[model samples]
Target: MKRTILVLSLAFCSLAATAADTSKGAESTAPTCPVTGKAANPAITLVYEGNSYAFADETAKQKFSDDRANSLYQKLGGKTAIDAAVELFYVKVLADKRVNHFFEDINMNKQKRKQKEFLSAALGGPIPYAGKDLRSAHESLGGLNDSHFDAIAENLLATLTELKVDPQLIEQAMAIVGSTRDAVLNRPAKPATPAVP
Candidate 1:
């Protein structure tokens, strides 16, 4: 289960990098409190990762701050760690035959930077991801399939493991990454089965 999540997260991270778009510049006009999901108090705002977030109250502000402080992005050592992982991941990917073709014509430096941003956002970093959604981006790949996705995930898992990231944290990050599978493949989301009591 844990391995699966890490792989998926890594796969999603790579996809995020190649096709992401820029987000709006930092603004003070957040419409809701990310912590409580309530209307924001314009006066109770904070800027993080180049974006502005507002809170309903002091408690909400603190809660949001604490969450960011404890996020997987923070746990993985922030930008430095993320940057190192992306670099290592691409080395493995470029050497792999299964998915390297997809990136054959891509500008890697830009892709690496985008991947960092995507992984940071996916891992609960302070900045929200404003890139083109996964489906649109992956759709442009034309020949993507499960095996390709799995290969990317595997590379990601290996990269994290080699980096000695905590097992539990890798699992958490992977679960988040795995959630993007359907969209990354540009397929329909699987419907949840109804509960049978």
Candidate 2:
């Protein structure tokens, strides 16, 4: 679940701007609307549960407000479920021949804590992530590739399945993880191809 949420949350963050400027009178830094991925109007805002959300318009603001009750974080049983999933995931990862080498000499206690924090925030938990960006963290691993990522993702899916999480949710979560592939692999993004005239 943590893996799923982390991927989804990161995907959401990569696609949408959850942090739009909400200052009372100042001009915004062109914050993108989480609902529309368009520049948000600082004046159009909603302060839900202490997090101020800026919107492109009233409709966007309303959508964000309504969606809060069903955030991925809450749906994945929040912190408790995330914690359990991360713990189980590490066990699988550590046991897997494909990815175990990545953690052989690392401090697991700290790694698990970071993973929990990262996945929690990625899944929309209240706390923001305070760790190394994915690229930098994995760039030093020399030969990291898609196959390794696939292995880790496979383990995550297996863990979630064993935990009996809903299949639909797992699919959603996997899509999110899939979006992080390039970043996790530290690869340069493919340039957008031009549209046919």
Best by lDDT: 1
RMSD per model, one decimal: 8.1, 8.8
* lDDT (Cα, tens digit) per residue for candidate 2, span 105-197: 999999999998988777676457989999988889989998999999999899778776677777867887887899999989878899999
What is candidate 1's lDDT per residue for 76-180, written digit by digit as tens? 666556877899999999999999999999999998988988998898776678888899778889889999989999998889998767798878778888889
Clashing residue pairs found in predicted model 1 = 5-174, 6-174, 9-177
Looking at candidate 1, the ten consecutive residues that score lowest on lDDT are 13-22
Model 2 residue 106 distance off true place after TM-score fit, in angstroms? 1.0
* Model 2 spans > 4 angstroms off: 1-68, 191-197
- Candidates in order have lDDT scores of 0.77, 0.73
